[model samples]
Target: MDPVDYVFTVRTGDRKNAGTDANVKVILHGDGGRKTDKMKLRNILKNDFERSQIDNFTVKKQFKIRNIEKLELWRDNFGLGSAWYLDYVKVRRKDKDTEYSFPVFRWIPAKTHLIFRVNDTSLPQQDPEAEQRWNELKRKRDSYIVCQKITGGPAQVIKLYCSTSLKGQVPKRK
Candidate 1:
């Protein structure tokens, strides 16, 4: 396989304490079972992954991964303020004009791993990875339960509740 270059742009959320000092890594997954080894994201000269910052990283691999499907990202719980708030990631192959965007507007706790799939609006049944789709749906179904608080009332899905203190810590929308 010919070596290919890929550029990854990571955006940090513009919220209080949204940056992290821990080491971050990523793995790119593509079609036909193609994947890349975990690569570290770092900038030695300047502090990276700061709040509201967009950092770019270049990765060169011998294998040319076609049609990127997902990105696996994680951070090592090292140093102070390890939690991070990721806004999104954009990836583009050097020779390709098309760019892939993965939106992940959420907080990543210390030492946590998360998978961000491409923004394909396909239904679960239409997903190519049947096992993954099934597992994801099953997990969601198990985590949320339907309950009726009042008689003859509509049922609501009950999932994990956020603590008031935690909610207060979140920044209010402008």
Candidate 2:
């Protein structure tokens, strides 16, 4: 197979201490269980993974990856202040004009591995990954609890848990 070029655009969250100096790696998973070896993301010309920054990186793959399904991203946690807040990651195949976006709006602590599925909405019952779907639903239910704000009124929702790094940083409602 001819070598293919994949462009990865990583967007860092625009929050205090959201950047990290640790080395980051990614693995692309495609249909039929095809996957690429872990590839390091780096750009020597300028500092990467800074807060509110978009960094582009290219990786050459010897095999073709069709229909990217999931992305595995992690950091080596090798540098000071290694915790990172990632907004999202977009991947594009230059030759095929194919693109996939993974929405990962969360903080990734040191030595954490995050697997993001392609940005596709599906019912939990129809989701292919049973474990992932269950866990996600459970987490959301635990974090966003339902309560009755008034008697004989519609139930109100509230988020009971917030990350320590995001406390007092969330934008106020307009």
Candidate 3:
């Protein structure tokens, strides 16, 4: 199913810090113009609040994607206190039940955005150049096997040589 909207869930580690109060920006880029969503987090909880005394503070935002190829999430701290300790960012969709969780077990500085590529499994088939290259590589591999086995050698020695020498020659998949 096509994605209609994205729901982002973010949580801060420290409850006592003002890091939870933030302005987050989400940008979705696709064939059309980029779509932006601004999220606001208010300072309801003060610095004296204990972490275990209450539930963790989390912020959620839902933006309409319509159609997107990739997206970026950013926290615009605008010169605040210490960097925010991010636990994670989860992306969900309205049409699909699948949810993608991006684990960010680190501190997020101001003005930094995390970019993600949308994995569209239903992408249109491209030119046959990639297929042709694969076929050629397969034929070359079979020839290499035949030629190597034609000469008698220890199985373990041949295996070691072939494995090490072919490491750099493998093709990368797109």
Candidate 4:
């Protein structure tokens, strides 16, 4: 299962004492269309409830999910008396052209998963050397194919195969 990581930034209202005290939960839908529950991602406003000055508060959080095909985010207000604002979610995949941004004028749905399409231009690009290597591998399309989440870091190590027919075989990393 491939693991995907995401970072979300959010803020609440300007009211000093009115914000969420509940935890935000993220649901991951993986291959075969299965949903897996992840740990609650705590909100900054909730953590610092006492020191909050309430001037357009904002907070950032990072979470990871393995075998993620799609994901849904939810937060239960439980009559917390205030609505939370989701600014945006940043995904590591380069195949997405834009980050997920929430609308400022409307209230977001209580239950929904944000969906995004992977575009060609959004795929991540490594350094010059890595780019050159990738191009070389791509040229031999019949012989090699690169898979996602090969490895994490500035220089990503994509899983590849010597040939398309060679399943269950991991080509040596150059």
Which parts of model 4 are misplaced by more than 4 Å? 1-19, 43-69, 91-106, 109-174
- Best candidate according to TM-score: 2
Q: Residues 9-87, candidate 4: write the lDDT tens digits.
A: 4444344344455445655454666654453555444452222222222222323333444445566654454345443
lDDT-best of 3 and 4: 3
lDDT of each: 0.78, 0.80, 0.47, 0.41
lDDT for position 5 in model 4: 41
**Deviation in Å, model 4, residue 62 alpha carbon:** 13
By TM-score, highest first, what's the ranking? 2, 1, 3, 4
- Across 1-174, the per-residue lDDT of candidate 3 in tens digits comes to 232545555555654453533455556554566554554433365441122222222334444455555556566654445446665555566566666555544455467666544542222245223453355456445534322322353322223335555454442221
Model 1 Cα lDDT, one tens digit per residue, 1-174: 787888989999999999988899988899988988888888778788999999998887735788999988889888788889899999899989889998878777555566778974466667665675566567656666555555567765556352233343332221
TM-score list, all predictions? 0.69, 0.70, 0.40, 0.34
Alpha carbon deviation, residue 129, candidate 3 (Å) = 26
Better of 3 and 4 by TM-score: 3
Which residues of candidate 2, in runs, are more than 4 Å off? 120-174
Clashing pairs in 2: none
User: What is the lDDT, from 0 to 100, of the residue 161 in candidate 2?
Assistant: 57
Q: Compute the lDDT of residue 74 as modeled in candidate 3.
A: 67
Give the Å error, residue 59, model 1.
Answer: 1.6
Ranking by lDDT: 2, 1, 3, 4
